[model samples]
Target: MARRVLLWVGDEAVHEAAGRVLHSVMDAQRAEELMRSYGEQLIERGRQQGREEGREEGLSRGRAEYILRTLALRGVHADEAARERILGCTDVATLDRWFERSLNATTLSEVLDDLAQ
Candidate 1:
């Protein structure tokens, strides 16, 4: 029940406070063990979330770079502002669209035409 309540609260500070209270009231060694277990679980969850976020960020960056490379190969000159727009974009679908456009685009304007809509 206490574990359920802590999980339901879903706050790290609350969990720490609860662990402290449990330690004060329960057998010190047992409480310490439980706290360690909970802390490990929390750390693992954080690491997993970080890994997922990093992977998504990498995918976004790779797509953006590929789009830029494709534009360069097609002889479409992207000015500084356009380059920033492409690099800053996090939407994979938009990047894919831009890449498809670059395949046949004769100018930077043509590559970014959908953005105007």
Candidate 2:
């Protein structure tokens, strides 16, 4: 009579040989929780970026409006369309130049000259 020997392997071998044998160990709820957590982190990052962009836009618009008002007081007429165009401009350096021009500009031509410069 001959004696027979049996071989034993770990979980990795078992998983590789067949499909998952411990499917019950991880449930759907845990997976859902992990996905939800990742989504929340992405949303927070987007919100932070949006807030920074909004603050920059607000500051730019305020500066443009101030320049327009100053020009108006100096007897330079800026119609609603022109004011809107000025406010829509995002170039900070241009806005600063316009602000300086507004200080000494007595006519629309002077203000327009600053823009050309």
Candidate 3:
């Protein structure tokens, strides 16, 4: 029987092997705990990044809308291409400058000028 063979090998040898196995199991459990903690931190960081990107995108959309509305209220007729350029803009300062120009613009081109820059 396997028990008889193990007994014949003596108690000292059996105890040493059993101790090694206990240590190996403990080490494996500690490594697993550390991995789980690290994974949670990475997930939190990804979520934070997503929120920041969403906020920035919303700001850009708001700026673009403000620019278009200002042009319309001033009776400036921006064609389709000019409308696209205004709506597509994301730079807040540049959008503000264009909105200011719209107040004094007699033609769509005046408000949309320097847009290529």
Candidate 4:
């Protein structure tokens, strides 16, 4: 079919047009591949970030619960304000310090004293 078209169109013009069409198709395919690759990478990055956020939330929540339980076991009664502060804290380092203090504290004030500093 191209041979017949080349004969009718003149060989030089037909070949140049054919070359342009081939180049355009190749460029289109290349563009599609690049977009697909970038899209996949973006999706994977989002999923990984979501996983990290979930892990951090779980750690904070678990640490808060442990702090409360440890205080109860040690007979250190956390008042309502102290309880809310401890439960609402999202910093793992602060929770860890509070947990350490709770193990030896006789009162809620003793457990949370460092937070005032």
Q: Give the best candidate by lDDT.
A: 1
Error of 3 at 58 (Å): 0.8
Determine which window of 10 residues in candidate 1 has minimal summed lDDT: 1-10
Sort by lDDT, top down from the best: 1, 4, 3, 2
How many backbone clashes can be found in candidate 1?
Answer: 0
Residues 1-117, model 4: lDDT tens digits = 433343344356655675466457568676455445545665677899999999998998889889999999988777788888998889999899988888887888877776567
Estimated TM-score for each candidate: 0.83, 0.66, 0.64, 0.68
For candidate 1, write residues 14-111 as lDDT tens digits: 87789889888899998888777776777788899999989988998998888889889988888999999999988888888888888888899887
Candidate 2 per-residue lDDT, tens place, 1-117, comes to: 000110122255553332232224456575455435545655677899999999999999999989998997888898777778788988888888878888998876666554445
In candidate 2, stretches whose alpha carbon ends up further than 4 angstroms from where it belongs are 1-30, 114-117
lDDT of 3 by residue, 1-117 (tens): 322343343466674574455457568675455445545555677799999988977887787777777777877777888878888877778787887887778887787767567
lDDT of 1: 0.83
C-alpha positional error of residue 117 in candidate 2 after TM-score superposition, expressed in Å: 6.6
Q: Candidate 3: global Cα-lDDT?
A: 0.69
TM-score between candidate 4 and the true structure: 0.68
The alpha-carbon deviation from the true structure for residue 43 of candidate 2, after best TM-score superposition, in angstroms, is 0.9
- Name the runs in model 4 displaced over 4 angstroms: 1-26, 115-117
Q: Report how far residue 2 has shifted in candidate 3, in Å.
A: 44
